[model samples]
Target chain A: MSDIKARVSFLGKSANILIWLLLIGACAFVVTPLLFMFSASFMPAIDIMKLPYPWVSDHIHRQNYWNGLRGPDGSFVFLRNTLNSLIVALAVTITTVLLSSLSGYGLAKFRFKGRNAVFMLIMATMMIPFETIMIPLYMVSMKMGLQDSYAGLIVPFLTNAFGVFLMRQFLLTFPDEVLDAARIDGASEPRIFTHIVLPNSGPAIATLAILTFRSQWDNLLWPLLVVQSDEMKTIPLYITKFMAETHSDEGIMMAVAAMASLPMFILFFTMSKYFISTEGLHSTIKG
Target chain B: MQYNKRFSMEQKKAVWGWIFVAPSLLFFLVFSFYPIFNAIYMSFFKKNLLSLKPPEFVGWGNYVYLFHSKTFWQSVSNTAVFTIGTFIPLVVFSLMLAVFIVSRPRFQKFFQMALYSPAALSSVVAALIWLLIFDPRGLANQTLNTLMRTSGVNYHWLSSSSMLRLSTIIVYFWKYVGYFTVVFVAGIGGIPDYLHEAALIDGADSWKDFWHITFPLLKPTTLLVSVMVMIQCLKTFSTQYLFSTSGAPTRPIDVITLSIYNTAIKDHNIGRASAMSVLLFLVMLILTWLQLRIAKTEDVTYN
Candidate 1:
């Protein structure tokens, strides 16, 4: 009886170990490309396409990193583009969060005719893919003389349905008593939002900010459509153009990718816990 | 008299709401709704870049052309296959991972963080990383070759057309699994522990308990996840463009969105592309509405 119990225990332990191994193996599979990308950024152009094996040189070509930093003509185009992307992303985040919060507060706190209709309209917009309207939107931008400008890139995406939806969801949970107290104190509607509501909704605001920033930073197609000049190129477009121009220079391409991804990686690493928790917050608002 | 008081309050509220939501509504109309209507209108025209003539109203010409085009049908089939291929495996793996991680509460946090990290990375970045791996001499093939040396059988994972599609689907699953897993974990966590406790006391096995207790409770979450996944699959373009070769056996892997992009931007056939986009939109809208209806039914049953 003791032997049988021991056997069962051993089998369970083995099964658990197998499960761990399988999980780890799957993770390794997913991580392989990212790992290779980092390593290949250090390899020479000729070596990049070569089969990575035991024969593959372990030597790191440091020049690839240097060449990546210094452009073909020794210009700071890549760095400038990186900075451009950062500024645009930050601007997008700030505008989106502030506007969405204000709008969300208005929708949530105010009782008015067609309030539900307005909210429904915003929600409906969320389903419309940008691809469906790319041409006319581009034409409109050109007609407004906003072509090749940051204003053009920023304006269309400034007020997102998703951000408004998220903020509305958060604001719904705001207690009516808090607003009543503020009203009783003779605070104006805008003042109540600024002093009372905004101060209290830090987590939701942060989550919206992160999501907005990430979306803008990684936005490719729209930015590609709008930004024409090299000066206006965001990081993704910069990297894509760089890849096309320097097709043979894998090292440089990888280096640029690393640089492009670094800021977002830092932001994500720092705020991942908050981001994960916000999923629960979404459920609460959704519920 | 009571109705008058309520009406006044509602009026005040409505004014505030409209004032606050005005900017969003304006942008939504200009950038979203107007564009959609414009695209629908454009779909009926025969417009070209060189010919600045008034768009010749050709009702259903673009749509008819789209239906007749082999590439369009091919794109539809590819999208369906890609959607189904990625969706099923992704949902299953994510649920399993969530369940496993949640089963052991001690290491749950670590597992959750590890799994969720990939989701934080953008789809573009994720695609780039996978492209590197699935390149001919890249890590995936290298590792496979090393493993196969003992048996003397080598395999090309990405070079072959079918394998390329399969590989792309796998990458899609890998990138999105964490996102759905996080959703599932949140959903599972929301399930009250009392139900599970009662089931345990009733002598239910783990699987039986999950079937009876956990599954029913997760209906809303499953609905939400399914809707999001379906929409996501519909919008998939960048990864396919990045990974697949431009022409030939691999060329057929181009999905509907990519085809629309090719037609509009590359081929400069904006009218036809707009037609395809309108069709795609309608299909997605119908699918979403159906899912919501089903979810409503499930909500009623479960509650």
Candidate 2:
């Protein structure tokens, strides 16, 4: 009986240790790729492919960043792509935040015929995949002579259904009497919206802005189709093309890839609280 | 007299409503609603993109051709395989991870951040990073060799068919599991604590409490995650696209989206591609409806 007790105690301790080890291991597995990309970016070109896995680039070469910034055929073209991504993402974020808040406030506070139907219209189309619409969107853009332009790139995705839904739900939580009081004080609807609602809805606006910016920043297939010229390519397009062009220079390619991921790192770290759970984005829809 | 004045005020509010929703509504109408009908119209014709002549109306010819095409069927099967492989693991493991993370309150944010960061990466970069990992002399092979203690474990991830399918699934799994896990954590968090406390009072163990209370309560979330995973798996492209273009065997990794892309963009067969899109959309629509119906029936049985 004493031997049995001793065995059980040892087993319990081992199990506890094992569970902790597994948790840490799982976390490490989740993060390995980004770490590898960051480390390999700093590795020497020759050492990138060396055996035993250069997990953390022993001989760090800071010049890899410079080499990667150099586009195919010695043109500083990659810079243009990075700039294009930033411009599109920022534009989409600002437009989405403004439009969604106004529309959300209108639907929540103002009584109108067809409001529910309009909201339903947006919700029903929410799950429609972009692939189904890309071809026709491309065709329409071409017909309108908007292809390969910044307008084509940013216009279609300026606002989404989820944005409207999120803003409406958040604004619904705020008491409505504040706006009515503003109206009694001789303030116009637009003035009340701009001053009262917008100022109060900071967290919700940040949520929409972060989600919109992240999705736009990471957009690829649409950008690939819309922008044909190297001058107009976004970061994903430029890097993919650059990678295919210079397949041999991997250290440099990794460096470029790392640089491309900088916005994601920045956006994620800054807005991480908003992103910690889908509760921020999900629960509002049903509510 | 008072009633008439109130009616006028209601009319004014309606006008303001229109003003507020106008811009976003206009954007959606042109971009979303217009394309939906346009794609349907294009699917009936032999619309070759490079040709100047107007599309020749083929009616259901593109659909018939797709039905007879062997490669189309292959792509359907490939998508199914990838969906099943990735979907099950993602749903199961994300749920488990969510449950585990919730148990450890102190490290929830740590694990959450580590997992969620990958979701922020562009598919292009994520695929590139994985491409490096799966290289012949990369960490993946090195670890495999060391563990097996044998020198002859070459899986030929890019060249072989089964291996290529598995590789794409792995790429997607690594990218999205954390995202869905965070969603599940939020879902689980919403469950009232009293149910678990009651189970404990009744002498139910943790496992029993989870199975009886937590799992059943998380039905809506599980459904959402399952549906999302299914749709995303079906629509997968960038990684598969990069793989084929980067010299991997294209046939093995030819997902439906890739085929649609090849037909429309590369082959310039807009009619065929549009038809494929319509069919894929129908599949998605029907699958979602079926799942909802199944859930409804289950609720009847259980409740």
Candidate 3:
């Protein structure tokens, strides 16, 4: 019996080590593409097919960044596109957070006619994929002359169903007693929301903001239709058009891809706690 | 008089509620609800995307045409193939990774961040990066060659039909597996620790514990992730779009969204595109409903 127990323990120990090795291997597989992208971005050009795989460039060539930013024709066109992406992403994030929080607060705290109906209406739309509505949305934008403008890019997606759902989920857990205390102190509804509720909603707002900003930053198809001019193009659109139109060097293309990803990487690294926390998962998962 | 004052105050709060919800409701009406209705309406009409003339009423013409169209059916099959191919591995691998990460003795965050790094990047960037790897002389073939001790063998990753499909699946898997894993980790975290403890006290082994407890409790999360993955895979556009436009054959990778884009913008046939959108929407709706129904039946059996 002791001999059998000893063998079982030994087997479990080996299994645990194997599992850890597998975990490390999976991480390596995940990081390899991005690592390759980063390494290739710094090279003038790489013989990517070289034996043993040139996982790192021989020398860090920084000019790829300059070349990438300058566009294929040396016109510095990508700067404008990057700025457009920043503007749209920032605008969408700010608006989505504000609108979602307010609406979420109302539904969570108040009992009103049509409150549940309104919440359900918004949530039901979550099932409708953006692709389903893309054609008619494009037509509506065209009819409204929203195409090829900042408004066209920003207006339709100012708020999202997920944001509302997330905010509501968070707010439902907020203490009603605090709101009642504020009300008893003669604080108005708007004042209470601005001072009391908003102050307490940091985690939810952060999760929602990061999610909204990331999505808008990476938005592609709608912008593909809405923006006709290169000047108005977002980063994803610019990258696609650049790749298609320029046939630029691989190094420069990787540099552009790296630049596009840098913000999200920074965002993830700096605020990663929010990302992996239950709050972040809460944003995506149903309650 | 006192009751009347209290009643007015309750009414006032309700008014504030409406005031707060009005903006979002109005935005949804214009951007979401109206567009859905419009897409359905437009599916029955023949219209040129660029033409100023009024649309011609075609009734069921667009739907019938799509039913008979080779390209439409091809897009549907491509979408089905991609969705099934991607979501199964996605659901399984992510769940496995989540279990691995959660069970680990250390560095859980490091594993998660490493896995989720790709999720942060745009699909365009993901596709572009993979395109480089899929290049004939790129890391993909080089890695394969070295691993197999073969010389100068090209996998034809982006050229061969089967290989091309596999390549897209690999990119998507890399991008989203970490994301779904993180979600699953969260789901596992939500399982009460005392249940695990009780199982241990009752002499349940780890594998049995997971099967009898964690897996059953994780059903909702698994359902959620599967549904999300299915919808996302069905709606996959950017990777396939970038890949095809970058010189890979369009026939193999021409997903529904890409087809919709081409039909509307390239072919200038908005009516046909709208009809396709409607069909895709129905497919998504029915699949979700079916999944939910299956889960419900299984729940009954479990009890």
For model 3, the superposed segments whose C-alpha errors exceed 4 Å read A1-11, A279-282, A285-287, B1-7, B287-303
* Candidate number with greatest TM-score: 3
Off by over 4 Å in 1: A1-11, A46-57, A280-287, B1-13, B147-158, B244-250, B290-303
TM-score of each: 0.90, 0.93, 0.94
Point out the worst 10-residue segment of candidate 1 chain A by lDDT. A1-10
Q: Which of the two, 1 or 2, has more DockQ?
A: 2
Error of 3 at B208 (Å): 1.7
Question: Which digits, one per residue and each the tens of the lDDT, describe model 3 over residues A1-287?
Answer: 01211111213767778877878888888899998998888886744445556766677788989999988788898989999999999999999999999999988888899998999898767767788999998988998999999999999898988888888878999999999999889898999999999989998899889888888988999999999998899999999998997564888899999999989999999999777775434466321
Candidate ordering by DockQ (highest first):
3, 2, 1
For all candidates, what are the clash counts? 3, 0, 0
- Itemize residue pairs with steric clashes in candidate 2: none
- Model 2 lDDT tens row, A1-287: 01211111213456557656766877787798888898889988678788876677667788889988876577878898899999999998998899888888887878888889878777555545688888888887888888888998988888888788888978888887887789779887899889999999988888788778877887888888889899899998887787688878778888999999998888788778877754431632321
Q: After superposition, how far is residue B68 of candidate 3 from its true place, in Å?
A: 0.8
- What are the candidates' individual DockQ scores? 0.37, 0.40, 0.48
Q: What interface Cα RMSD is found for model 3?
A: 5.4
Model 1 lDDT per residue over B180-258, tens place: 7877887777666666766767777566666787787777767667766777787787677655532224464788888
Please state what fraction of the native interface contacts candidate 3 reproduces. 0.61
Residue lDDT tens for model 2, B1-303? 585476786787788888898787777777777887788888999998888899999999999999999999999999999999999999998887877667666677888898878998988999888888888767777767888897747768777899889999999999988888888887776666666666767877656767887799887678767876887788898999888877788998899999988898899999999998888878876665655454444332222
